[model samples]
Target chain A: MSFITGKNLSCIRGMKYVYGKVDFTVDAGEILVVVGKNGCGKTSLLKTIAGFLKPSSGQITISCADDLQSLDIIHYIGTSSSLKKQLTVRENLTFWSKMLDSDADNIDKAIKSFGLDEMSNSQISYLSSGQIKRCSLARLLLAERKIWILDEPETALDNDSLNRFIDIVTNHVKNNGIAIIASHRPDIWPDNKKLLEIG
Target chain B: MGAFLAILMRDLRSDLRNRAQFVMIPVFYILAVILFPLGIGPETGTLSLIAPGILVVSSLFASLLALEKLFSSDISDGSFESIILCPVPISVIMAGKITAHWILTGLPLALITPFLAIMLGLSFEIALFSSLIILLITIILSLIGAMIASLVINTGKGSVLLALLSFPLFIPVLIFAAGAIDLAIIGGIGNSIAPILFLCSLTSIALPVVPIICAAIIKWQVR
Candidate 1:
């Protein structure tokens, strides 16, 4: 199974500490919820794991069951939806699938799985913020990565959309996928997860 | 190859849908080129003599209008982060973006150069010949713009900063491209080969190199 572990991990930006001296581990089929006060480096820590930022000290390593490179098996969804507003839902998803070199079949499946069939042809700019968030989340299914790094994924999501998100993450973990989520609402997360608190 | 085409097509599709923005580049190019003749007087000899430089400089300014959006939009929308983190090589991804920028701004501008060239008292043959040089110079401008755009992505005044940074880098391209066209107009078509070959060599070097540099700068910007 795949696992990620951080030892005495610290993140510093602009000569100031965001988080420091922390250790955590999560394995396949597990979720790690990173919680903290605003500006506490929760996002920085997630970015560090995603290889977007270099940690000021310590190390975070990913060991997957397969021989794939760590970056190849990891997906990071940040606070911004990353969906192009000018394009329709299907267009955005299709672009991601192609960029990731994923199977073309997943395009329609992702649209259907996210309940975006009716809105598939609607431009993202016309959709509600919640709808836009759903379109971005559909991107997760476009690739077959082992690790998912999500930062504030629940923002702008409605109750129904949040439930859908939970289901997707649950299904993902059930299939031996690892999810590392950074969120303000730890209570809304699935029961099967570990918590890493930051300040 | 799939990832590369995907990024390129995605950008092209987006631009096509935004017709106003898509049309503005060439419209601006045309307007700017037309202004030179009006201000310089309709003297054919003077206009013909300076047509190459006028076309090159005006197109450069027109390109600046679209450069800010090249990387800053992706950064602001957070699409840039996802784009870089994708499975494809960063260079390939950036190459797609640079190509897309050229298509949206450069290609269209080149297509309309004949009309603009005629307005400046250039013959159809010389206009057609100069369009080729214009196309090459635009490609180089797009490459240089991509790098400068990525570098200034997070700055408060990205467009202003982009203009300042890209202006200096664009000087060499302007010289060769305009010089080539000048030779074609003043001398014979065959006489322009030296500068045309120089422009080609510059494009050859930039085609492969700029994307790598852009990739590194983008990673650094996000980091």
Candidate 2:
């Protein structure tokens, strides 16, 4: 069975329409890249799949042993990064750690893995743009969700950080996790990555 | 219970982190009360006559100042989104946030009213009793104000909209709070306590119900 599936998804914001009789599925160990131009509802599609936005006329089926009510198993990293500027890096990680209910072992590993230890005390507002992006991406790294929906995760990072981010995405997919990345940058993904174009 | 406690702790921590903004509310409350005597001349009878109204209005305004930030910051930072996605009810989260807001703003203003009363020439009993009444009324009014602020979270100029939405709702609370003190000063403490008790009752009913309504409105707005 597919880990995540959306059938006949349709969405409309204001008067602008965004819909098609689209059928899509993501399995356990594959990366799907969604490429489109500026106004192609890429973020909307990711939001719909992540259960943040309700499609006007469609059904989303997320397969898991848990009941439907407990199936919010997707972690979303939208364009805004959504990190509070007032909070220090460690405080921000601690907040998400508590939210995810991850044990200390996993949280420590995530902090180390993200190379966030040295800058942990710095407020997010003080971080460089690349650091801010890394701080936001750290949630995707730490969360145990089976599905990851990342929107424009490569926007403000240097080449080194972008390569490191690709490594993290590849590692997540290697662990039987599904990823849906929406970006205009095609060179970020590996050659074997599945491409889905939406206009 | 865990979710409620988490929200309360988070909000309290956030409020404490912004010490200057939080501290200024009570400071302003006290300063506003002190200024009243300067404006109207410090005649003992006149100061005594207006002290209760001054205390209640100042407390109301101080509480309102912090109300706008109650949910907007959380909503803008995506904290509200995470909370909404939690298994817990949004109403519970809203209640926790509103309760924390009251503890920070309303409670401080109420606690400082006794000091303001002494400066304004109120008797000891009148000062203490008036503080108690203001505390009760401020708790309720803060919750109602939070509800109004949450409803207008997405609206343009939310603070003004919150005031426009809440001032009418605040009339009854202001009336009972000031009236109870007035009655006490005139030697009708027995008559005053009943209105204060009624105000408390209104708050008790509003405390649980208004947040739920406001949460519903917020859900609709986000959708």
Chain B TM-score (model 1 vs. true structure): 0.97
Score residue A2 of candidate 1 by CA lDDT: 33
* Docking class of predicted structure 2: acceptable
Off by over 4 Å in 1: A65-70
* Leading candidate by lDDT: 1
- How do the residues B1-223 of candidate 1 rate in per-residue lDDT, one tens digit apiece? 8888988999899888898989999999999998987899999999999999999999999988999888876787888778766768888889998999899999998999988898888999999988888898999899888989988988888988898888988998889888988888878789899998988898999999999999889988888
Each prediction's TM-score versus the true structure: 0.96, 0.91
Error of model 2, residue B189, in angstroms: 4.2
Residue-level lDDT for A192 in candidate 1:
73
Q: Candidate 2: misplaced stretches above 4 Å? A: A19-21, A65-70
